[model samples]
Target chain A: MKWIDAPWIELLRIALEVAATVAFALSGVMMAARKRFDAVGVCVVAFVSAFGGGTLRDLLLDQRPFFWVRHTEFVWGILLLSLAAMLFMRQRHFQPTERAMLLPDAIGLGLFAAVGVDIATAVGMPALIAVMMGVTTGVFGGVLRDVLCNEVPQAFSDHRPYALCAFAGGWADVALRQVEGTVVSPLLACVLITAGLRGLALWRNWELPAWRV
Target chain B: MKWIDAPWIELLRIALEVAATVAFALSGVMMAARKRFDAVGVCVVAFVSAFGGGTLRDLLLDQRPFFWVRHTEFVWGILLLSLAAMLFMRQRHFQPTERAMLLPDAIGLGLFAAVGVDIATAVGMPALIAVMMGVTTGVFGGVLRDVLCNEVPQAFSDHRPYALCAFAGGWADVALRQVEGTVVSPLLACVLITAGLRGLALWRNWELPAWRV
Candidate 1:
């Protein structure tokens, strides 16, 4: 309720939330299509991937009436997107290239990381926990998506710096918490850092060393 | 707090919760061993399998300090069990048969379904939603486990009567809500119905027909 009521800030938050949702939804849809899942499976997977992380974060914060439930428009947006995407892909026989997915996915991860940090901080979570929550928010959706698609989560196994990027951005958000009214918004700064790191990682083929036993 | 304060009933609930946790943890350990996961991976997978469903439920209900966080004993139980099981498995080179997993998994499913229904009802959820939540609690851990282990969810693909059994049992729990002073405890009745149906289904090799799209 309070979240839905915060005027201009709330409007900006909603916009970011939509962006994050669309990014994740696109990722989910692409995966589902790759798996050749039916239309129903595509929509379900897309919804879960788009909404799962924020839902988990909200529930952890004990926020009632989930974000999607509160803003049915988000749900509608995903549904419409999935429908359109599915139809377009079916008609055009187009497969989304991995490179096509990279930009939105990176942007979504950054937006979600910032949003997660902001929400957790608003709920008075400890700074470290808030940062962790931010990473969870950014990465967990993809984890759910990958899991549902019967793959080891890219976050856990691919050794890419996905979660690490979010982690760094979260720490940045926390460090810049005191610097209000700067030239760039701290939230925007967090987003930029995360997206930049993820993009750079992709470009440079950066990876965390895999642990083997 | 109220859940932990219901005296005798709470004690029974706690016992059931422990039983379910151990059952699920064992299944997780068995799955991890089958995958030949390292100790850390084993423990992480086991924890998620054992706690994921209830954690999801608590978050949805806006219950804070998640069930595992509040009942640290459950967390300890899972950790210790995972460790012991891993050591025993490694030393003996033992792989648990699917049959070994069947009984406990079924029992845990039933118990968790009842607990889910009870919690949802207590929170004043609609009967249908509560029943759905019950099935979710009963099946989602295994879903998470299967997904993490890079397999399609047995509930979705096995076409088995697993979740359907839980759904039926949950509906029974809801239906019997008005029946007070019954010979059978409603909770126990729900458990028996779910476990019985699941057992029979397994014994008879019953499955839902796969829908082709």
Candidate 2:
């Protein structure tokens, strides 16, 4: 908690947040392009993907002036990014592949998970609920994107350890916070662990057992 | 504004709210059953469809202690209703047709739209935003239901006048609110007009023009 107020930590958190937002927005752009959605649809999807999870977290936590509303730049950034991505992909005849999305998506998941857990813990949420919030913040944007695109959420149905990585990272954050006065930032540790696990899972081709009827 | 504090009006509003929640929950159950989702999926879908729209409205408006959270009974009621619906439908071999869903869904839409508009207006939102809130409250739950079922939202893609009906009803509520000291409740009027228009659309087989590339 003491380390949380450090100037460099705050800067690092903001940078990670921006990177995560861009990553999520890029995933949305790729999905929309693959679906051949119109320009308006593409922008809407990208905005939702970039902001939906944080918005949901804020709502559940009863926070005001949603992150996007508070930071108008996020809205403008997504709009411009969507337009640029659409044009660039179309002009180059670039195929948006799942393989291309893997790295950024994993990075976003970890960063969002760490931020979510911190916020929920700050608000005095129970440990389990905080972890759940972390998973929600990390995974829900993609869920919303898939839902808008008329498909089952890849997080739930892809049979991979996605949200689980966030869950573990949240616990690590919680555990690290318990150590009195350690200089090691829980936020950084959580992000690295979550993203590392996801990257490893992908590289190893790990799979979770799919539900059978 | 004067009539809002009236005891009978409050009672009527509560009754309509309950009816709308039940109707929305029913629609979710039918959809989940149609999709052959398991018991947990059925309950989850029903809960989402019943609560999603109002939750979204509250989030957008920065309302705290969401309506369902304020009333614990709503949560228990949906859980019980889900269980009961599953058993009854299975026992009766009920084939849930789209036709069978129309009446309840329309009633729910109108009621939700009226309530949404009133709440937004009470919160001092401008007329247009209030009307949009009404449409969001009426239509988003069903959108979530369809999204969960892995299909395009009927509100956007069915080419029917679903959200439009809510939009029209919201404006009626807004308009009536402008008239000073009317005994005729705006909530009642909005519900009737919205449901009536939706009913007419179904009977006359009206369709919105499909989007062309």
Indicate which candidate wins on DockQ.
1
Report the C-alpha lDDT of model 2 over B103-199, residue by residue, as the tens digit.
9999999999998998898799999999999999999999888888897677897888999999888888899888847524788889999999999
Note the Cα lDDT for every prediction shown.
0.82, 0.85
- Candidate 2's error at A28, in angstroms? 5.8
DockQ metric for all predictions: 0.14, 0.12
- Residues forming the 10-long window of minimal summed lDDT in candidate 2 chain A: A204-213
Q: What fraction of the native interface does candidate 1 get right in terms of contacts? A: 0.19
Clashing pairs for predicted structure model 2, backbone only? none
What are the per-residue Cα lDDT tens digits for candidate 1 across B1-213? 354345787777778888998999899999988888888888988998888888778767776787788889888888899999988877997878988999999999999998888888787777766876787788888888987887776665555678878888998998887675431376887899999999999999985643331
The residue ranges of model 1 lying beyond 4 angstroms of the native Cα positions read A1-5, A32-48, A55-97, A124-133, A144-213, B1-52, B55-110, B124-132, B144-153, B156-213
* Cα displacement (Å) at residue A43, model 1: 7.3
Per-residue alpha-carbon lDDT of model 2 for A58-139, expressed as tens digits? 8798877888887899899999999999889989999999999999999999999988888887777767667767877888
Error of 1 at B131 (Å): 5.0
